[model samples]
Target chain A: MKMRMLLVAAAAILYSSSSLLMAEADGKWLARVPDEDKARVNPLAGQAKAAAAGKIIFEENCARCHGVDANGLHNRPSLRSERVRHATDGQLAWMLRNGNPYKGMPPWNSLPEQQRWQVITYLRTLPPAGAAGGKP
Target chain B: MFASPAFARVLSWAAVFLLPVPLLRAQEKPYFVTYSTDLEEPGNLEIALKGLTASPKDANAFFSPTMELEYGATAWWTTEVYAQGQATDNDSTVFTGFRFENRFRPLPREYFVTPVLYVEYESVSRADKSILEVTGHDGISSFQVNNSQSHPIVEHSLESKLILSSNFKGWNVSENFIAEKNLSNEPWEFGYSLGAARPLTLVASSQRCTFCLQNFDAGAELYGGLGTRYSFGLAQTSQYAGPVFDFRTPAGVTYSFSPQFGLNDNSIGTLWRFKISYEVQQIRDLFKSPSKRNAQ
Candidate 1:
């Protein structure tokens, strides 16, 4: 009886700890950024209005697959980490204009330039990976 | 004795003049007059002609304003007469000949293969006569005595065609393989086609152009045209020659137009052609619903 109780207690602890670890892993994965070899910009600084407009544009186009809050979806990379934080606005602009064809992303150069900039601005506001309820 | 360049030029001109006038007359019809290049096999006109030549019972089986008559006396068939006076004045041509057709079944029907055949013959009368002839008694005498007299020469032909067709889920697919001999005196030519079609936008009063793979002999065809009211289509044949345009107006009539343009080699001028057609209502009704008549 004693041994059985001990085994049950150990199993419960193991299950809880594993659940916590899985939650942490999910957050990290969702917050991981793309394109690490780029400079960073504070999207919140002088372009708050642009970023606000960008949020709307991003939701209209990118959010369908990228997730509502810019958090990554299944197989899509997050924008919270060093890679996204360090990317230059121009680089993001380029990616938005001419999408990665090989990656099945369609070019949005046909869209207005202001709209492209707005998407870039919105991408900058996503919280980093481990924040509560910030990522999947 | 040698013929000088001057003499040769005169002879050539003489030959061209001496050649039958009816040959040019036959080709003088307006470009819009429909002409199917498939002369070896019985074309729609030929089939109608055959029906007309048959007994009155066969005549009842066919009804068309344009009529033709053909007859074969022996194992070899002879004579093809086409008459269309509705759009012209006293214009018709008769092609008399003996044709030999031998069909060979190399594969089973399950394989989608059918019997193939070869036909060779000499077309006679004005239309079949050569465009050029030899001049002078000496040249004429040589031509008369020579077994290979080029004038009124034999036009040889051999054709192999296989047709496979099937229908699935309201869509139809037809494939055709054809090979011809003596293309402009060249060795032989071959072509194949696969066509698929399906109807879209089913409505009581909707006009939709059916999509097909081989509509214009191309791989894919989408039928929709200006204002979503008209149905227009562009297709490419399997040979990838070029796109052929087909259109239908809101009147529920169908038409096909092939635009051809090239440089006239002799005149160094522009050569252009625009063909248009309107199917007779009787024929159109037979193929489609008359309530949905559209323009071509």
Candidate 2:
């Protein structure tokens, strides 16, 4: 009995440490993506096709306030920013799956993975700052 | 295209009937009217009058085309070639010349309070010199012969303007200053203007009506006016010459008619004038989109 209890304690400690390590690694990965290819990589690599698909999703879901180009009309932050640019694919997927309670960002879990990716791909095409040439 | 038959008829009737009402109630608006027996007067009266009479929508829509070419010989200074012209009432004038505007600001925004120094050599010429000379005087040449009577008008002017804007609930206040001098003659003139704008009601709607009051020259001139800026549609205002009483319909169209009265410069008698304008918006959407190529 004494040996069993010792073994159980050891196993619990090992499990907790592994989770802590995993969390740290996730954070490191998030940090690396932003600092690494931010200025070098073209964020809009496959966006043209993705945006075409995303436009349908945007019109159906987001157009009431965000307008056509994701340029918010009233009081919404434009998707054209470093915040969106730095968001990892997984982070975007998670945000779409799980809604933020504090802000009005709604949970879009009902959307399929392909549709969510389409939206993400389209948002990536938006300039991280400044207005476009012929924006209405 | 959207003006219905009944609506068009009603608008025509309103224009006919309300046209005289503005003249009768000229004291309640923020516009003054002056006439010119000689069209070639020194001031921008023609442009100002035309702008005043133009439909607010159309006036805002027009680009007021301008082109300027300047050369700077030194680092801190250079010469500037300035040319600006606008056509209205089938007539226009081009003012072309050079100006030396010095750049000195204690603080960039402080320019609002301090005057900007400008020394200019300009040639103001009529768009139709032949017509003007024939109608007004004989043997009046365009550039050479008109030296004595039509010499280049040289001006050294220092202008300062201030605009303070804030909103308390629904009220906004703005102040303007304009001061200038004729370098050669040393004739100095200054004007101060204060105005307020506010909404009339708290209806949660896209359309907004703003009423403004401006007192000019320290109460020497007073003007009160109302305007409504619409969303999602076009309002075209007519381009005419005179005072303007402007109003916007619920359908996102603007109409302005004004009767003007003011004391003549000689203080001899009050001047009375009439003007009308129609505001049209969103007319550009009817045209095809332009090529996206950048100019060289």
Please report the interface RMSD of model 1 to 1 decimal: 29.4
Provide i-RMS per model in Å: 29.4, 25.6
- DockQ for the candidates, in order: 0.01, 0.02
Place model 2 in a CAPRI quality band. incorrect
Q: What does candidate 1's lDDT look like per residue over B100-144, in tens digits?
A: 333222221111222223233323322221111111111111212
Index of the highest-TM-score prediction = 2
Top of the candidates by lDDT: 1
